[model samples]
Target: MRSTAHTDPVLTQSGCSSTAVRALQISIAADKALVAEVRHTVRTALESWGASVIADDMAVVASELASNALKHAGSEASVRLRLSEGQALLEVDDSSMQRPVARRVGAEVEEGRGLFLVQALAAEWGWRYREDGGKTVWASLPVPAGSAA
Candidate 1:
C-alpha cells in the first residue's frame, strides 16, 4: 500500500490514466488484513468518480479475486480498476499462472463460491496468463446509469 499512488502508479500495478481511460491501481501484500482495505478503497474511488452504483459489485469482485490470489497463489497481488466504455473493469494480478476454476458445489457447502459470486456480480469475467509468468483475473461490471467517468 505504501507504493506510489499514480492517481492511485506502476507499470506493473497501474497503467496510470488519461482523459480517454480512467484508471486506478494498488499493489497489495498477501496479508488478509488488506483485502477489506482493498474493498473500501475501490468503493470510495468509484463513488468519487460517480460510479457508486457499481461500487459494491466491484468491491466484491476485488476482494474475491484478491483472496483467491492470497489463498491459492500465496503471493502479493495487484488490483486495478478502470472505466472502459461504460463498464468498470477490475483486474487482479498475482504470481500464479494457474487459472481459476469455478466449481459447482452443493448448496450446503460454504467454500469454493468466490468465483461463483464474482460470475453473478460481474457483467463478465475471465483470466489470462501474462507474459511475465503471472496471471490476471478480470471482471467487468456495468457502470451505474448516467454516471460520468
Candidate 2:
C-alpha cells in the first residue's frame, strides 16, 4: 500500500517485493467495473513504458486474474503491475490460500479456462503463497523495444 500525504510515492510493501522496472498497485472490489479499472491501469502503465503492443494481452491477463480472484478467493484481492528490465509482470493478491489449478480442456467443465488463457498470453506465469496465508499469482511477458508507437 502507498501512503502519499500529497507528493511522496511510497513504493515498497512490508514483505512483497519485485524486480519490475516500474510498477503500480490498486485495491479492487469483487466487481466487474473494478476489474475493468485494473485492465485499464495495466494498459496505460505499460503504454507509458513503451510496451503498448502488449496492452491488450495485458488487459486480458488482468481480467482473467481479477475474475478468478472474485470467483475463487472472494472480494479482497489487490492487483499490482511491474514493468522492469524489459519485462512486464502482473500480479493479483488474494486472501485465498488455495493454489490455482490449471484446468484441462475437458477436465469436467463446460467453460472454465481462466488460468489457461493466462498461460497462453504470458511468457511465463506462477504463484507464491504468503506466510500469513494469502497468495499472489504473477505473470510476465517481454516488453518490445518499439511497442509504444
Candidate 3:
C-alpha cells in the first residue's frame, strides 16, 4: 500500500490555497488478488483527505477500475487520487488501449458490470489513451457538501 502525495505548486501559484490540491499515486499489480488492497488504499487516501463521506463510493469505483485493468489489460496498473475544491478524481492507468465499454448485465449474470457500476456511482467518468502505450480510466466523485475539502 505505497502512496505518495504532494502539493501542486502551479495550482498554488495560480491563486489556489496550498491545501486546495492534494494527490496520491499508488502502483497496482496486474493480479486480481490485489483488488482488496486497492480498495483499502482508496479508503485510506480518502480518509486522510478528510473526505470520508465519499469513501465507500470511491472505494467501489476504484475496485471496479482496477479489476477492469487486470481482466482486460492483463498488465500492471497505477491508481491516482486527486482531491481539490470539493472533488475527488480517481484514475487507473493500465497497459491497454481497448476502451472500456459499459455492458448491460441481467440480474442472473455474475460478471461484466464494472463500467456500469462506475457510471452509476461516479459523478463523471471517462478514459483517455496514454502516449506511451495504454489508457487511463478516470472517475470524478464529488465530496459531500460540508465535508472538509
Candidate 4:
C-alpha cells in the first residue's frame, strides 16, 4: 500500500502545509464500464482528504463528469480530486479539444443529460482546453460549512 504522505518535490517545495491535505490524482482510460469504480475512487479520495462527511455530493459530481468524458470525449482520460479553500474540486481530463457545451434535448431522449446533471449538482462547473492538447471539465462543490469531517 502507498503511504499517505507527500513524497513528491512539487508537494514538498510548494509551501503547502500538510495541514491542507495533498490532493489525489487518478489517471485511467475513460471506460464506460468503469464509471462505478471511478465514482468509488473519488469517494475514497475525499475520505482521505478528511472530507468524508460531504462525500455524497462529491461522488455524484465525479460520476457525472466521468460519464461525460467516457460518453462524449475520448477513452483516454484522467480524474483528479482535491480539497482546498473549504471546497472540493473534481476534474475530468479527456483527449479531445471539444469543450462540453450544453445541448438541447427532447423529453423522449434516453440519455445526453450528463452536463445538465453536473450543473445541477455541483456548486460550479466548467471546462478549459489545455495549451498542448485535450481539455478538462471540472466542478467545485463547497464542503458543508463547519463540517470538515
lDDT of 3 by residue, 10-101 (tens): 34555755555778888876779889988998888789878999898999999999999989999888999888878999999999999999
| C-alpha lDDT values of all predictions | 0.83, 0.77, 0.88, 0.75
TM-score of each: 0.84, 0.78, 0.89, 0.81
In terms of TM-score, which candidate is stronger, 2 or 4? 4
- lDDT tens readout by residue for model 4, 5-116: 2313234355775435457776667567778877887787777667777687788888888888877775767887777657888888887887788777899998777788
What clash pairs does model 1 have?
Answer: 6-9
Give the per-residue lDDT digits (tens) of candidate 1, residues 26-143: 8988897899989888888788777888888889889898889888889889998887556788899999978899999999997799999999999899999999989999999887
* Candidate 1, poorest ten consecutive residues by summed lDDT: 2-11
- Which candidate do you rate higher for TM-score, 1 or 3? 3
lDDT of candidate 4 at residue 89, scale 0 to 100: 81
Badly placed stretches (over 4 Å) of model 2 are 1-20, 105-110, 146-149
Give the alpha carbon lDDT tens digit for every residue of 1-149 in model 2: 22111112334565465333466777877675677777777787777767888889988998899878877887668888777656778888889988999877876776579899999999999999988888999999888765532
RMSD of each: 5.2, 6.2, 2.0, 4.0
Clashing residue pairs found in predicted model 4: none
Give the CA lDDT, 0 to 100, for residue 30 in model 2: 64
The alpha-carbon lDDT assigned to residue 79 of candidate 2 equals 85
Off by over 4 Å in 3: 7-17
